[model samples]
Target: MAQVEITINSKNYRIACEDGQESRIASLAAMVDSHVKDLVEQIGQIGDTRLLVMASLLIADELVDLREIEREVSSEGGAAVPGDGEEKIVSALNAMAGRIESIADQLERA
Candidate 1:
């Protein structure tokens, strides 16, 4: 295992991961940081732990919203073929949900 240092909500974290997983860890950190930044920008200077918790909740809400939209679209046969805009949106939403799940799992483990 290797240690990766990441900064989120202006605080640094040292997380352990297997070798060759540095990029993935960094990517996860970036996402968290982005969320935290958004929260900070909106609310202006909250406690780090509270900000992190709020960020997680916001991310989870986003995932749930996307899943609902995906279900509705699928039920309505919105994406009927490849190359169509609806198909692309559905695909993107699926990928995003997968990423969000992975991030949530990681956060839970952390």
Candidate 2:
């Protein structure tokens, strides 16, 4: 295991993860921090625990919406066929979904 230092709301946290996952862990922390910051800006400070809960819900909703959009696009044959942009777009979307799932898992554990 390796330790990664992540910052949220300007506070630093040292989290442990499998080796070579430092970048992923840092990305996860940045996502959470961004969400929390947005929430705070929109509604004003509401305590750490409450803000974190709200941010988690908001992030979850975003992930669900993205997944739904991806499903719709796939059903409509929007994915690119051999040697086309559609294939690249589809691949990118799949990668995003995987990343979102990883962030969600991190939020849940936090």
Clash total of candidate 2: 2
Tell me the lDDT of model 2 at 35. Answer: 85
Listed in order, each prediction's TM-score against the native is 0.66, 0.69
- Estimate, for each residue in 18-94, the C-alpha lDDT of model 2 and write its tens digit: 99999999999899999888666655666888778877876786677667757866776875454555564566667
**CA lDDT, every model vs. true structure:** 0.75, 0.75
Per residue, candidate 1 scores C-alpha lDDT tens digits across 1-110 of 99999999878999999999999999988988998886666555658887788778767866776777678668869765555656655776677656655655555565
Model 2 clashing residue pairs (backbone):
80-86, 80-87
Per-prediction CA RMSD (Å): 8.9, 9.0
Worst 10 residues of 1 by lDDT: 101-110
